[model samples]
Target: MNIQGHAALVTGGGSGLGEATARELARLGAKVAVLDLNLENAQRVAADIGGVAVQCNVSDPDSMQAAIQQAAAAHGPARILMQIAGIGTAKRVVGKDGNAAPLDDFARVININLIGTYNAARLFAAACAKLEPMEDGERGVMVFTASVAAYDGQVGQQAYSASKAGVVGMTLPMARDLAQHGIRVCTIAPGLFMTPLMRTLPEPVQQSLAASIPFPSRLGKPEEFAQLATHIVTNTHLNGETIRLDGALRMAPR
Candidate 1:
């Protein structure tokens, strides 16, 4: 489907991959809506791209509905929904404290990453289903963000891994279920990327992680991820798949 003049909604569009995708979509003439928990940063990106900014919590149904309404009001119902808002907290299931990690911590990650994706995808699809189908009977596309952790999580990442795994697990089923509506679903399981969060780590640690990749050893640029997103949006045949954006890296257990 052509991105030009279509409405695109990107959660976590304040920074990192979502921000990059939003910028790219706008560059391609899509009407972009930048949604993030950080309204200030979302506003900055939205202003930069001449798009709409909405403060959203993907985990809450009401919050997501409000955000979707705000974006649709500005740019019409989104035909491209990018789910990227997620959080990861490193805590061993059995920490040095000799206790299992708090269940609330686990729930928080799942709520934000897994359930949040579902909330946004469902609402976006509902809106798209009402629209007239585009050429090739296409109505919309959804690109979800997963993690390499979902498949090969090291220690101290039980909750994070489980949440991401749920995302990976849902890709095909979601795609199949939405096929009848002319909506496509796919997931990107990114490895270590030089996101703002990763940049905060010590240089040595960052370098070590980069070195772990087999070849072209470096962190992935957010633009590279955005490039893939653009391709997925345009490539009509691509659906129900999880593509790994890693540089030949298979993480070892810590």
Candidate 2:
């Protein structure tokens, strides 16, 4: 479907890949809504893009529902949903003192990354299904964010890896389930990128991580991710797939 004149919802639009995506969508002439837990950040992006800003908690049913409603009120119902809001953690399953990893930590990651994705997709699908189908009977498209850690999680990444893996695992099934509703689902599992969190690391550490990628020898750009995401919407045949945007980089187990 053409992005021009369509309404789009971007979670985590406050910063990083989500922010880049929101800007790209707006640039493509889509009516964009920047949704994030941080209202100030969302507002900043929204103002710059001339889009709406919605404070949202992806894992909370009421919060997500309310956000969607608010966004729709501003920009009409959205046909594109970018599920990108998530958190990362590095916690060993067994600490140096030999205690088990806290269940809360694992739960928090799963709730936000995995369950939150489902929440956003389900809500978006429900609303999109009711919309008049566009070309090829397509009502909407959804792009989910995952990570290379899902496939090759290093040490101290059990919670983060598991949550992302769940997203990867859900891609095909969710796409199939939404097929009848005329909604497409796909995932992007990215490798090391220069996100805010990654930038906090020392320069040498960042360079070391970038060197791991075989070619280009640099971190993936947020705009690269945004480009692929928008392409998925335009390319109708691509569905139920998890495309790795990692520039031929398979992570090593640490």
All-Cα superposition RMSD per candidate: 0.7, 0.7
Minimal lDDT window, size 10, model 1: 88-97
- For 149-233, candidate 2 gives per-residue lDDT tens digits of 9999999899899999999999999999989989999999999888999899999999998999998889999999999999999
Lowest lDDT sum, 10 consecutive residues, model 2, at: 245-254
**Tens-digit lDDT track for model 1 on 1-254?**
99999999999999999999999999999999999999999999999999999999999999999999999999888899999999998898788989988999999999999999999999999999999999989999999999999999999899899999999999999999999999999999999999999999999999999999987799989999999998999999999999999998999998
Per-model lDDT: 0.95, 0.95
